[model samples]
Target: MAKRKFKKQIYRYECTMTGEAFKTTREAPNPNDLVSVKAYYELNPDEDDRPEEIKKQLQTEE
Candidate 1:
């Protein structure tokens, strides 16, 4: 069996200076044109996401 891939099916954008939403997909601004951009996604929900505690022995070496 082969794994599958997913892509973003939808996107939206607004003007940075005017605060108006774009009316059409073709009119949306490039991400670089915006003052700031934010992307959202999920990662490894079943596993611990934080770094493991450093052992005292290794900490002293650094």
Candidate 2:
């Protein structure tokens, strides 16, 4: 049997108010890496806009 490969995805998020950025990697990000990447999301609800922006940027690139 052939081995299946798990691809690592890079996700980036920026704060809408401060322009601060966060980044991380995951094998398969759920809700999105921006939402699940770290514990910061739980602490800062306002920074959750990155997922949709990242999705849009990815779509545009492809």
Candidate 3:
């Protein structure tokens, strides 16, 4: 078998209070929950170039 490389997506999140920048592979569940948003930054992040996370909650509503 041959080796294969998979590209993992990275996301950037911010803490509305501290104004900190963080990176994560998955979207933050309940991004509106500002408390959880701050907690996300407490975790470790990947060391690769990743795209920024976009919040589309406002656009999806009719």
Best by TM-score: 3
TM-score of each candidate? 0.26, 0.32, 0.44
Residue pairs with backbone overlap in model 1: none
lDDT by residue (11-53, candidate 2, tens digit) is 6666443455766674333433333333464467587667778
Q: Write the residue-wise lDDT of candidate 3 on 1-62 in tens digits.
A: 99899999997777665666767899888655443342443342443223443223423551
Which structure among the candidates has the greatest lDDT?
2
Output the better candidate (1/3) by lDDT: 3
What lDDT is reached at residue 4 by model 1?
86
RMSD for all candidates, in order, please: 14.5, 12.7, 13.2
Considering only N, C-alpha and C atoms within 3 Å, which residue pairs clash in candidate 3?
none
The 10-residue segment with the lowest total lDDT in model 2:
28-37
**lDDT of all predictions, in order shown?**
0.44, 0.57, 0.55
Q: Rank the candidates by TM-score, best first.
A: 3, 2, 1
What value does the lDDT take at residue 35 in candidate 1?
A: 32
Better of 1 and 3 by TM-score: 3
